[model samples]
Target: MNSFLSNAKRSCGEFLSSFKISQSTILHMVLGNNSCDLDSCVSAIVLAWFRSQMKNGNEVYVPVVNIERKQFRTRTEIAYLLDHLNIDSRNIICIDEANVRELSNVGKGFFHLTLVDHHVLLKSIEYLQTYVKEIIDHRPQLIELPSRIKCNISLVGSCSTLVAEEMLKNKAFSVPSVVETLLLATILIDTSNLSVDVGKSTPRDEAVVKQLSGKRTKDELNLLFRSVADAKFSVSGLTTEEIILKDPKWIENSLETIMMSTLHLDVREFFAREDSIDVIRNYCATHNLLAWVALAPVINQFKPIALYCEDDEVREKIIEKLIVSDLLLVKTSDEDHARSDVKFLRMYNCKNTRKQVLPLINEVLQQRSSNLSA
Candidate 1:
């Protein structure tokens, strides 16, 4: 056997021995196709830990969610790791069964199942409540899983990072350099390179990033950031609507629409030249959109100042009510925040800001419902 494979096998044996679980019954369910950076990270970390414990004859199954094609990368990496260890790829299972009845009947034996996922599975939760062995995830709902099943959930960048830390803590195995780099790259990609707009990058993610990069230079971090940014869908090929849908937050139904305008500026460019407020005003007019808001990051303060138009009349009212000198009217267009927006919204309760803007969204929704009824 090659040195790498040999080392991997040895680590697997050591991990299994430490756990005291019978090798034949431990089945790993690697949750694939996570949209959020944190979910993907957790998936990778847990899979790596499981890889270390897998014996030659042991069976490990990776199930892909049918709905999330974007999560294919996690499964692909797991396959590669298995191949490197000289394990057959056939053992990996792609789960297509949409219902729990089918999943529960797949196989029977001395089995301990581990599931890592972000989606809410009400049926699966009930099933797991009765029979699940363990689950590691970032979702808050998983807290209700029976105590008999081990559960780990955190609101951090990625679950993979958490899993990696746990493995290291238990002295399971040293993170291979390639694996370390991959994990760090995922974090930077997901967290937008620790942009302050995203929630503050956790110390764990920072430590891992530094370790992977081997040096803390701006140039190196920038290169990694560029690499991840490139992975995003190209602007030319996708419509603004498609791009907005790609946001993980959008998937949760918290937002009705998003509008954004970009401005390029040089050192000499004045805030007036940016015309961000005016551009937003024009967008609102053209689209006849309500509940429109604009966010510009104040990098020094690490907070996003959201400027929104209440309904046209309301905007006028608010401007009049507050007697604000600077007020701009605009239509709603659809655009989303890059990485920093994810962090900013979550960190600053940007969603709750809707309480003030709710009137517009409600008005829009009501109008739509009326139109449909007509």
Candidate 2:
């Protein structure tokens, strides 16, 4: 086992063990988002380490949020990265491993949490609502918790960049070389190696890398990114359901449950697979998923494609409004395959990522609901 990983495992075990000793103790859990993407996972681990070092005697553990030990296999890139650093998945503690309800039973002020990667808490994990202590995220701030907590929300390529900055500024313990590599890989992949065309990255991202890798060149970062990306985009053994589930963000509205899936693979190739469509439909049916929104990176030149499931009247109405409201949504060329709820359309404005498109879809759904109520 790697020294860093062994140390991490020992710390996590000690943290969990401390929580069991008493109901009067304050146990701080640094948790990532449900997506469990590269950025979220990295931010949780690195920030938790930094915080634990600062806390001196507090109980702090970083738990991989919303994912089980076995489910780590679904996140191929995460697995590959951990494996590269000689970190064993078994050493890490998953969300399911700890009894959340048991934490709630431990009494007030006994359990505290610090969120990384996401500002808002999922409905499923609302049990931890009163326990939130701090939040560090890169996305726009959504909700403000009542407690006096440190909130670091910035517009960076990756949340990990913000975490790295904190570590550097605090003059925290010297970051290991392997840990530096881990942080750099996340930023490179998330920002597409700081490509301006993607527009997700900023100068801070590059500056951070330069600081972390004083003598290293851009080529080395690119090489590391390619290695990680190759692992991320590999879908040889993953079924279509697994592909959809990987890096999925779930949204629960008053009406229904929706899953927004983001993929790094070629959209055209995914659409061509009939089995893929079946898998999505079957999974949706089994899980009672009201809708599924699929977005992929630009593939086939400037042709960007977006897919959505509109099997019923409500979903169809949402889709209709989405097309009408979205200037980027080019409905001129769309194909609804027979017997499949999924439909694919070419996005003329490739810049509107899932982040931009999601709001439009939600707006449409909201408007439709208002009309029905009126």
Candidate 3:
């Protein structure tokens, strides 16, 4: 790992060593989004490292992964990339391990927060909204923020591009080759290696890649992108539960929550797992998941979506909503789901990502809640 990151890592370790509610020290942290994907993780870690290197004042900087500590290992691409960079994952702060709640409860002034990869705060941590000092995200601005907060929301392939620009603006050129390469990797992943066909890559993303990928051949970066992308989908060692939580997207609303887990393996293989139903139920019960969106990409060419719900009535309502939408959902039963409590559906819609699916599902959940309240 680079010396800057190494020092930041040590600082994080030292901070945790004596963390307490009564402690006088203030923490300035870069917090990734709750989803904690590769882009979010990289943005948080690298940006924190950059800030600490600047040493603006007596501030103590830390990068926080916005997930449970255990969930860290399940994020394969993140684990793999950090390991490749020689960064010790143990040194990083995961939310479950952080004293964020204790600190937040102490007061909003106790800590300063900079949100990366996402603008809106998760409901669980919305209590810290007043402390949000800055935001760097690629998504369009979702809501208004206090004039005191510095918000940099724009359309781009990855927030990494924004961070990379920040680095470049402030002579992050002195940043290690490894860190720059890592940022390059994130941009590639998010923009599908700047693939025109993917169309996720913005001109800004391409410009950043060109600047950072000096001397590195196109073929080499392509190989690296493929390797990381494959690692992202390889659920080799994860258990059934981990598989579900690996890239799980928790959709929350006023009265409902749903989990949409994206998997790269065949839907049949996931269905074949011995404890699939049990794990699904456990995950649902914990979150009161009104529905489960099992989105598995088969052979990287087809997408099979399965919606699971224990309540047959709720399941039918969700099915009705999905079937009527543009998702082109076709209920399929390759296995014997006839006797299972959790209903399943197989829809082959590759073009529509969670960006489209989540809102549709949320509408169903919201409408259902409204009906129940009525």
In terms of lDDT, the poorest run of 10 residues in model 1 is 261-270
Native RMSD of candidate 3 (Å): 3.2
Worst 10 residues of 3 by lDDT: 330-339
lDDT of 2: 0.72
Q: Per-residue CA lDDT of candidate 3, range 52-85, in tens?
A: 7787666787888899987788899998887887
Runs off by more than 4 Å, candidate 3: 1-25, 140-144, 299-301, 327-349, 368-374
TM-score of each: 0.49, 0.88, 0.87
lDDT for predicted candidate 1 compared with the true structure? 0.42
- Best of the candidates, TM-score: 2
Worst 10 residues of 2 by lDDT: 332-341
lDDT (0 to 1) per candidate:
0.42, 0.72, 0.79
The pairs that clash in candidate 2 are: none
**Per-residue lDDT over 1-374 for candidate 2, one digit per residue giving the tens place of the 0 to 100 score:** 24434555555455445667743345567788888888888887777667766775546455545576666777888889988987776766577765666766665566678889887776677878777778888877655667677788898889989999998896646887877988999999888888888778898998888888866787887788999999998887887777887878876655566778887577767767778777877788888877787777775544344545655776666556656755565553444432345566666667566666666666655565577577
* Clash-forming residue pairs, model 3: none
Q: Point to the candidate with the largest lDDT.
A: 3
Off by over 4 Å in 1: 1-26, 32-101, 107-112, 117-119, 122-131, 139-143, 170-172, 215-218, 233-245, 249-374
lDDT of candidate 1 over 40-88, digit per residue (tens): 5335344634554654656443333323333333333333344444544
